[model samples]
Target: MKHRHILLVGASFSGAVIGRELAEAGHRVTVAEARSHVAGNCHTERDPETGVMVHIYGPHIFHTDDVEVWAYVNRFAQFRPYTNRVKITARGQVFSLPVNLHTINQFFGSTMRPDAARAFIAERSDTSITDPQTFEEQALRFIGRELYETFFKGYTAKQWGRHPHDLPASILKRLPVRFSYDDNYFSHEFQGMPAHGYTALVQTMLDHPNIEVVLNTTIDQAAASGYDHVFYSGPIDAWFGHALGRLAYRTLDFHRFSCEGDYQGCAVMNYADKDIPWTRITEHKHLSPWESHEGSVLYREHPRECGPGDIPYYPIRLVTEKQMLAEYVERAQAVRGITFVGRLGTYRYLDMDVTVREALDTARHYLACLERGTAMPAFTTSPL
Candidate 1:
């Protein structure tokens, strides 16, 4: 077996997974992360004040229908059974998220079955707009004005700092209003949180004999050239020095506070009013129900435009950003011995399962390309 030196930038799931795979395949992999910690945005640490495992960035639930990914994560850490039942406060009323049967009944003050609820929403839906262009239009065509305005309008405005109509319709497609009583936030078959925390899980993955992790450092093209191949997971635009202009991204600022007992009864409580400064409050203790803690830690999330130093959460991917991403893709493709991978690298919003799945796929693809004596493309998965 031939061993090649590989440079992997960003020690998050993207870099860790690929580094582990390459290392196991007899390659010497070096992982460099700009952050002091390893897990990137998925980093988690124990709250000293409350003794609760806190998701430093935000809550990340491992939920996936992909059996291989589920099993792969389980190998690293014990995953406890957890279901995200989200609650939203809107117009002085609390309701279950996804606008389930109970939410519909409670919001309208009527006792209705699943079928009746379906018919009621259908009657209220704005049929005049056949082809919904924007998020606001999509909401009007499906859930009607009342549900949209009450639950989505104000929330969307605060979340994106823009009107729902100004944003793409794809944003609203992520949320689904269920007609059934199922309040589970995700519909995946396997859903759980790592018992120890995501950082521990990621650390376990990077614990390979053939791998060396270098933290508090960023890798540039010149520095990466010494390696046989480089797997970059940083922002795509940043890799090229943002020559085509910076891609749009949304970053979150959390106001962390400690409470005596239960702050919010649930793990997540969304404020669906524009007047509210923060978007949602997450109780760290609730996320780890398997452990008992005397105090609770809470984070009030506020979304804003990503700046130079802020951690980019999700790509905006509006028309202008897409165009700029296209330019970056062109420049990246011209480069050799480099492969951009993961959410930041591809400038796409990816879930944890999808990130792992893609990492597995990318490793396999890279191995195949090596065996065939072929050059690996800049991106294993298309960003656009």
Candidate 2:
């Protein structure tokens, strides 16, 4: 196959993985990042004062079931085994996350076995709702009113910037209620964190001779003709300059502070009360157990609506927003010489592993399209 110029927007996992693979395949790749650094939201940096690796945006734990993706990331940076065991503060006590058997037994002040605990929770759960319609209904049906109010209600409201009743039932399905003692936040077979940070990992990926990285450089549709094909990982609505309307998204605000010792015993401690304001408090030192730091950097995370010039975090695909997303999808489908990729481009909240997996698939699909002499799709992956 002949080499062609490729323009990739955003220097996150989506862009890094795709650009690296394509560059290795002899395609001249140009990566333009709006930020001054690579690794978009997963960007990690050492706190200048404390020497602790702080997740500049937030905590990103690399966990996936895909063996290939795990191996792919490991090739770039040394990955240290890390399991996220989150703790939550709710109703005046700390409890294990994912609501395990221990949590249920402790929460109710009763020593019950797994079978008894399962039966007890089932009795408490609202069985009348066969099919849950909203987030509130789903939680209530799964764990009953008390547990829902204690564990999920306020946190869910804060995280999405909407009342639980307004959010879809599917949003609550990612969390699992376990009858076992396993407290691992994610059930993926592989999980770990890079020894050196995500930025260093991405820098290594984009170190190919065929690739050119231009940080703090913004690329738009007008520059599409400069490259043979553009791999755009930017916001789909923003690509069109929000012509239809700005799709709703939730952004995060962090209140960063430093302390002499461990701020929180655990890496993450979520505040499950609306009155608390901030959703969670994260201690950067705990995230990397391999490194020891006398001083710790912490971030009190507050979630809110993504306003103008805010870094959009979670895409709120409410009913109306989904309709708007469909319009944006249609507009993108009509365009040529550009392929939309990644979370913002596809308008979905994707994990790091899934993003890398999709990037690999997108690059492979593009290569296949080239070999067949077929036109590359504007969206290799659909937003809706």
Candidate 3:
């Protein structure tokens, strides 16, 4: 088989994995990242003063049920077991997250078993509405208005910069209200954090003889024509220069500060009250429960509207934005030699494991196409 020149834009998890796979297959792969560093949003590094492995962008806990993805990441870096136990502060009281049995008991001031708690919550729930329409309705129908208002209402509004009523019902699909005492944030089969951090993991993926990395470089549409195959991990809308219309995205602003000692008790503390401007407070030291630090580094995360210059964090896929994305999908179908991969490429919020899994699947698909002498897909998993 003849070797092909593969150009991958964006050195994120998706781009890095695809580049490594293609490179190992005897294809010459070049990765171009607009940012100076790799590992896009999952970037992490140790604090110089405190010696804590800080999540530079935000907290990223790798968790997945896929055995292949878990084994694949372990090959690159050692992962330490870390389970996220988030706490929310509302009305001057701190409570366990995921609306667990402990949360229900504490909130109502009673000791209830799983069965009793389940019945109690059901009785409190508003079942008048048969079909839920929006995020607000879904939350109200499941946990009742009191819990929803105290836990999700203010936080959701602050995070998205809009009322929860405007958001789709699918946004609350992942929300879990447990009847048991389990407080783990994620229920994935495999869950851990990289001991050396995400940057190290990405570095290991890119450390291949056949893979060449060019950071702080932007690849234009014209430049993409030179490569035999193109893997674009950048924003799908930006690829077409927003010809259809720019998809709305929410960006985050972090206020970093160096504290003398421990700041927040936990790694994440959600401010559920509307009085608080910031959404959550994250202390770097608490992220790695196995390690300890003298001084601490903290970040007050504030969600903001994404503009041209701001770093896009979350894509706000509302009703109108989905329509615009459909138009972009139509345009992408006509484009050749390019395969859009990753969260931004698909314009959907994805976890670290899902992103890696998609990239691995994409690589396999590309190999299958090569063997069959078939054209590569312009988009994997419908953008619509």
Candidate 4:
């Protein structure tokens, strides 16, 4: 059996998972990370002043129904139960998120039951617009103008920096308007936060004898060719020096503040009004409800377009961006001795579980391809 030398860019969940798998399979894996920390966007560290676990980027609750992924993460660190109950301030009043039965009743000031609330919203909704195309249209068709303006309109504009009419309808589809009073943000069967921290978990994942992790090191195209095969998890456009121009991304700017005692009395409080410059305020201490803290640390999240040196949070896949991505994908496929994996590599927005699942699949596919004496394609999953 010939041992292969593989180069993996980025030390996040995707890179670490794939590197560990390949290293365990008798391959020498080298993980190159530009950031000093291991976890990328999911990085969490203890606040030096407040002694609270803070999500450096933003709150990332681990919620997924994938049984294998859940078990895999638990092997590294103990997961404490967590339910993301979000609250929103709209029209000078606080309401439960997802526009539940209680929220509908509170907004309308009626004691209507679930069925009656449903009927009331139906009456309020614009039934004339049968087929919704844009985000604004979808909101108006389902929840009516009042709810849309109060909750969705201002927030959507601030978050995306574009009018809801210009965005795709699918962006709003993930948000559910529930008839029940359930306040859990996600509908997944398993939901929790790692007891230690995401960075610690990632460090554990990269703790193999055959794996070498280089921090604060960015590998260029010249270094990529030295390895037997390369697994690039960095930005797809960066790999090619942005030959087709940079793909648009939305980056987040978080404002941190600390106060003694409880802050907002909740984990997350979203300001639905557009007047507010920042989108939401999250109390870090409340994120770990099991632990007690004398002081609280909070962050005001503001979303804007990505600029140079800014960490891209979300990919803005508009019509033009999709065409640009297609062109890059075509060029990427022609390259040999390299494979693109993970979210940035494939140029798609993916959750932690999906990233891990895809990394496992990519490693498995690579091994199977080698066993069959066949060459692996640049992307295991098609970006287009």
Using all chains and alpha carbons, the TM-scores for the candidates as numbered come to 0.99, 0.99, 0.98, 0.98
- Write down the worst ten-residue block by lDDT for model 2: 217-226
Question: Which tens-of-lDDT digit does each residue in 268-311 have in candidate 2?
Answer: 99999989999999999999999999999999999989998999
Order of models, best lDDT first: 2, 1, 3, 4
Clashing pairs in 2: none
Which residue pairs collide in model 3, if any?
A: none
The Cα local distance difference test for each model comes to: 0.93, 0.93, 0.91, 0.91
Tens digits of per-residue lDDT for model 3 on 65-115?
Answer: 999999999999999999999999999999999889999999989999999
Off by over 4 Å in 2: none
What's every prediction's RMSD, in angstroms? Answer: 0.8, 0.7, 0.9, 1.1
The reply for model 3, stretches above 4 Å from the true place, is none
lDDT of 1 by residue, 65-170 (tens): 9999999999999999999999999989889998899999999999999999999999999999998889999999999999999999999988887899998888
User: Per-residue alpha-carbon lDDT of model 4 for 98-203, expressed as tens digits?
Assistant: 7788888888888998898888899989999998999999999999998899999999999999999999888888899988889898999999999888989999
Better of 1 and 4 by lDDT: 1
- Which scores higher on lDDT, 2 or 3? 2
